[model samples]
Target: MYARPAHFYARILEAPLHFARIPDKAAISHAGRLQREKKTKELKGESDSTSKAKPWVDQDLQDDTEIPSPNQGDDEEDDPGSELDLPHVPYAPPRYAVDSMLERSRDFYTLLNQRRSVRFISPEPVPREVIDNVIRTAGTAPSGAHTEPWTFVVVSDPDTKHAIRTIVEEEEEVNYRQRMGNKWVKDLAKIRTTWVKEYLDVAPYLLLIFKQTYGIGTGGKRKTHYYNEISVSISCGMLLAALQNVGLVTVTSTPLNCGPRLRVILQRPTNEKLLMLLPIGYPSDDATVPDLKRKPLDDIMVHI
Candidate 1:
């Protein structure tokens, strides 16, 4: 039997960058029944636990389901002028020899294979310029309609970091006690994670990534940022690779019920929504990671 940690179950509320555990069928069935019962009570006004709406949900929308488009209420005359009017330029990047290409690919794979999600981080200061260059590399990711809709907020101030930590911990505590069900709590017992996030303060830098849902165009018209989520996700992948290349360590976290408050505290405009939070620094001397294995190529790849 596994002992459930209330705080450990909070990850289910916000979601994670990666899901390393799969709950058993019996557990899933139990959780489904519980959710159904809760919904029934809520419908009958017999429970007030969720009397108010969750901050993350867009309450204005019906059923709190649709994410409002930026161009939804714009007048027909509010034309967002064409952004691709500029002339295209010809360019060619260097092409390597066949042998060199194979060697480089193998070396890159080896480097990335060693990358791990390290929670223990050192307080040693790192060069700011290195971080700048890594972000620059991430900015080169392809975007839909060339609308590069992403913002990276880097926080280093001790006070500000503490404030962010407080908010995350408070929300996490509430979610664990009131929101999470038993299935998720039991599933997370293997890795032993809790709501307490000391690394938010211990890491030298906190990188918060946001995705811009829309862009402001000429005459203050709103322009649709197509596939903004996918574009930002690609950039995040490049960012992780860049950090690994520079021998830095970080763990990706998506804190549930904490986005709106974090955005307000950071003073980001309403157009932006938080996507990921990463605490980055050198690994601590005694840092450890679970012994895990990647799936074989045969299991992951589908050959034609």
Candidate 2:
């Protein structure tokens, strides 16, 4: 213990440096994946307790409900003021003298309440401009990551509608007979909807809304879209409002077996997934809907 070898002293000096090497995130993730596979294969024979202690390897952890993202451990609080270089603008708005805002809001709510899902649509022709304007209004909805991932396909051609109806009817027949259980059949009985979808032809126009899962970039690389379901749902709601604003009645549907079949019929691109089929036109003379009441505000809302 009087004097250590030069090699031993050098090793002692390098100990802290070894620990201080900046973690290569991509390299660590790849290595971690490989190690995880090795661990999986070894787990059948032996158990290891030091798996979590390795600082160089990122742990792939999951809970019963959800998988935790890798970025969960990132210290975002360290860069509290960090932001993208976006243009700044002064806040400006004209203050209203009267209570028109509140009055208009109440009136709008009342008007929307009167709107109904019309199943029987008259085969009356509507101006193409009306559909275009309504769709434009729907497009104004906010999207996730500014990715406007919605495509509306309007179907007015008689032959296409007939084909879609035929395919949907076939699928719906199978669903009602074998796929759907007794409870489901009983639940649907109140609505009086049958496998035969004659309304497909009766409706002057069919608006098929598709949600884009991933967008293809300039190099044909697929870019992930965030919150596509939420974004499209908001857009659909706005579409309904817009349609109602123009006195057009619509009934939205998620028709059984229609999605894949419709895609083939419509010749849609791979990135889009069918979301809703809205049969839109003037309501029939005896058009009807289920007389259901909406939930009270107290039941739906929680005041904190």
Candidate 3:
């Protein structure tokens, strides 16, 4: 076999070392450029992207540093593990319990069962403190991954209520005339719903429920939340029960036009998705609800 020249062997020995140095040199140069850009932005009174980008880059750098070189031998002294030190944390089980009272539960269920979908509400003003207390009760609901993703906005100002009513009526008019076909109108015929939303303005308070689709953690990273819709719905149920328990009447209004309009009117953050708008107040002195009956327990329940 023919042997390579002495210069060829020299080139082989130097190539690996040069290739290894190239990555380190590139990393250092990139770090320097990032620092320079950060400084330039600071001097110009502009926010630097470095602070926002550093965590990701730093993590990558750390991963790269942990990787052993291809030429490293088993006998060579290993790098110290100080960079990868993880503190020992003691394990502690969660300590929380729910107190169940059968009697109270029975009464609560009974009260909720009496709640009717009131449409003809009185203009009597509901106390602000009552609404606040109801919201506090709702905050105790079990939520997805313990992320209490719900917001209740209580609007009481007459002008704001009037504005909401106008916007809602405009949308409802279009819905009744054009959007909602005859079959849809027929289905709602017995319920007696109208395009004119006088209740929006007449009600003492409009409770807007928002469901947080995602939570913003520290540094604005989105944290995943579980059962966001179910959690919000559960909380809303508890809120309605609490409101009824306090002797205040409420109507769960679902004007198809209200969701988008309320989103614009409230200027809510994008993370918060609108759920439903509830008009809450006292019923009129002579207010009357439809004489409707609910399905029997046997019909709704199945014993498996």
C-alpha lDDT score of every prediction, in listed order: 0.76, 0.70, 0.68
Error of 3 at 255 (Å): 2.8
Provide the TM-score for each candidate, comma-separated.
Answer: 0.73, 0.69, 0.62
Cα misplacement distance, residue 300 of candidate 1 (Å): 1.4
How do the residues 61-149 of candidate 1 rate in per-residue lDDT, one tens digit apiece?
A: 23222256565564322322244434435568999999999999999999999999999999999999999999999999987556678
Which segments of model 1 are wrong by more than 4 Å?
1-72, 76-81, 179-193
Q: Report the number of the highest-TM-score candidate.
A: 1
Q: What's the true lDDT of residue 112 in model 2?
A: 88
Off by over 4 Å in 2: 1-98, 179-193
Q: What would the per-residue lDDT of candidate 3 be over residues 1-304, giving only the tens digit for each residue?
A: 3444433332211212122235677678668877887888888988764454321121211322122334333332121122224444467875534444666667777988889978767788777888999999998887744567898988988998898888888887777767446675664564236877678888889888987765555444444344566777889888988988887887776667466567778887665666778888888787788899999989999998
Stretches off by above 4 angstroms in model 3 are 1-105, 179-193
Estimate the TM-score for candidate 1.
Answer: 0.73
lDDT of 2 by residue, 1-304 (tens): 2343333332211212122235586457657876886678587765555344344311111112122333333222221112212344466787655688888888899888889988889998999999999999999987755567899999999998888788878888787777356665665564336776788988889899987765554444444454566678899999999988888999888886567678878998665677789999988888888989999999999988
- Candidate 1 lDDT at 225 equals 58
**Span of 10 residues, lowest total lDDT, candidate 3:** 11-20
- Candidate 3 global TM-score: 0.62
